[model samples]
Target chain A: MADRGKALALPVTLLLVFEIWARSAHLHSDSLAPPSAVLAALWSAFADGAILTATRDTLMSAFAGLFLGGSIGLALGILLGLLQPVDRLMEVTIEAIRPIPSIALLPIALIALGFGYRMEIAIVSFACIWPVLILARAAVREIEPRLMEVARALKLSPADRVRKIVIPAALPRIFVAFRLAAGIALIVAVTVEIAINPIGLGAAIMAAQQGLQADLMLAYLIWIGLIGFGLNAGLNLMQGRLFGRAALVRDRT
Target chain B: MTRPVIYWRIVSFVVAAAFVGLWQLIANLKLVSPVFLPGPDRAWASLVRGFTAGDLASKLLGTLEHMVYGWFLASVAGIALGALIGSSRTARSYVAPSLEFLRPLPVSAIIPVAIAMFGLTQTMALFVISFGAIWPMLLATIHGFAAVEPRLYEVARSLQMSRLAVIFKIALPSAAPDILAGMRLSLTVALILSVVCEILAGLDGLGHSVLLSARAFRSADLFAGVILLGVIGYLTSLMMSFAEARLLGYRRGVL
Candidate 1:
């Protein structure tokens, strides 16, 4: 732990110096509020419930998209993987469309879905789905043929084979894909919210910036960083627990 | 399996064609507002106009400049730092935790800080792109270098190779694949960040152009920009993949 603290010293020192200077300088007219000012602004925003509401809305859009898009992507990926016909039919089109950044679709989505939570959720979902689907499909296709043959030889029921063999085999890669998708989802959610000026943390940051409330904007920015950090850490922990067990099982086998 | 593959190919093509055809039909039928869903023809015309006018080229060039610089810097720094840390257990243990702490901070989240520090200048855009590109490159380099077979090091030591010689001769080659993979990851991310920064900061690039068109309600122009951005992204990824294949063809042959 002492060594770990020493390891972190550089980054922490840099951040501390930056915060102090920015605060002391009263940089960018108060719009670039110092760390202390940001904290005060954060307290005020919290008291006013604006921060809470915005956070809730952002989280709602993020998780809703994650669930909806993740499910669809997994199903489509499985279909594409298991059925060669589906893969051939859809691969080119998916590839063509997949390269388009999710943000690029925002204007059309805005026009079609209008400016609201639904639009935000749809865009986030669309963005999140592709990576998960692509990874899942690849994982499925890569499953060893011998494993499938063993299941068949054992006279394992189709459902049993799918549930026991297919899912477990795909789980590790799927989780890896999910890690990537999760980052993309958070990014898309924030960007969509910022672009659309929706009632979320993203919007609050924009509003603060526009209002030249540098401190408030900085506070919101810090909150976003914290949220992203927490989510990644949580996911990393979950991945270790789940995939570690799977890895252990494989080792035993 | 062969029959299924053929069937899937046919189905996928049909589905894709049908989807595009439906868009064309819907636009012609006026089923949706042209403002919302411009047809391919309109988008194509706008794309041609943008290209002919030289605006597209300039904007693309602008975006590409920042992306290339940022990516190049990130790759070099990541590899060097990764090598340093990977060479020593103490360095890895000490540096790893801080890297983890910093890595999860979203590139977008830093825009506010960037704008504050650099204002609305190109520096802000470059900073954001570099930040986005750096973490992946760093992590990948570390992973690559750490995973280098110990036997290679033993061989190098047995040969009385100098530290620099060992790094260049053994460590770098062994880590090349991982470093290259990391570069690939960074490329996509750097591109995305470049676009996003341009949009938010309203810089003169494809992202800014798209946002401008969208806000102006120029659906065709917007779509044209979108399509161009997609092409750029696609082409970049293809280029990276091609390079990787060529450079790493030996590994593929080994496999």
Candidate 2:
């Protein structure tokens, strides 16, 4: 309770101060909006369902990109982790490509995919792929040698071995990787929207900015922050529930 | 073993060569519009021509300047604030919650806010970049300082070390690894945010160049801009790694 109070104290105080100042000064700047006005803006954005539609568009593209990129990364990571010859052959190529900021490909994606969900997803997925691939490859490679020995001794086929052993062992780490990728997916998706694509929360914020609706823009900004916070908290909870102490313990080690 | 390793090296070369070969073939065959999928030769030529004749050099320098300035500002502020909060348990208790609440904010969301505040200027980009890039370093610094061994504090107490001296001498050294790691992440964040801001604001940077080229349907120039950005990313990261190794060299064998 005390901790909660401590946490709320700073933000609440700041908000109150701003509210008083804005009200007293009758600030008319396009950028400055009172807390009350922002709240009203938020309530209206929600009431009319504009924010809802924007949220849906953003989440849809983010999830689609995450799913597409995560699967590819997982498959490729497992292949590279399991196959020494292939890993060796691909190492140079991977290293060479890895440092390129995914945002730099925004133009290429724009050129090929045009403006819409496809363009946004293409960029997000490109951003999302690296973390999952790097972490998943590491996770797979770090699996206990005894597990592989057991699989071999049982004469499990490669497919079954991977399905039954490799995945289960590496899953917790892979999930962590997914969490990381999911964050990137949202970030890249918003970035794509803010840059050019005319869909999603980012676009909403931009629209609000262009319209000089500072209150609405601030409302959208707060909403995006809330969405990011909620996504991270929800994923962290899921990770804790699914993997429990095992993942937590290993992570610290 | 050596033979297979050599063979793998040979295979790696072939694979890379094949990729370029395939791209060239596709371009030659006009599988995709040259406007959309320019050949590697064209991209390379464009890159060379850009540095030699175009304003690409200036754009590159602009981006580097923006990224470095933002990163430097973030580092200074992050370290100062992090130290202030990290040194006091009460301060951490009060501040950490707010920091946690703020940290998960999608950094790009602030771009619009900055634009509203600064009206699409270089100052807006600087503000957004610094704001976005500060979190990692701030958190890392706090963690590093807070996690310092109690025994060190005891020793410092025995030595009658001043508060500032203790922080500067003991805490800072112990926190170097985490702080360095944070700075590295912050640098990358700064670079990405700088690019995003430049693209949105139509600033004089590689990002703006790429956006303009793409809009003009100059695929070769667009590709060249992207390659230059990638090269910058690669070189900066390489430099960071070298710096990390140098600073953390003593801890290498110990770890």
For A1-253, candidate 2 gives per-residue lDDT tens digits of 9989988888999999999999999988788799999999999999999999999999999999999888888998999988877888887677667777888898899889998999888888878878889888888999999999999999999999999999999999988889888988998898889888999999999999999999999999999999999999999999999998656644521
**Which candidate comes out best when scored by DockQ?**
2
DockQ, structure candidate 2: 0.73
Pairs with steric clashes in candidate 1: A31-A214, A85-B8, A89-B8, A89-B12
* Fraction of native contacts (fnat) of each candidate: 0.50, 0.73
lDDT string for model 1 (B52-102, tens) is 975988998878887888899888888888888877778887778788777
| TM-score versus the correct structure, for each prediction | 0.86, 0.97
**Chain B TM (all candidates):** 0.92, 0.94
Name the 10 consecutive residues with the lowest summed lDDT in model 1 chain B.
Answer: B104-113
How does model 1 score on DockQ?
0.46
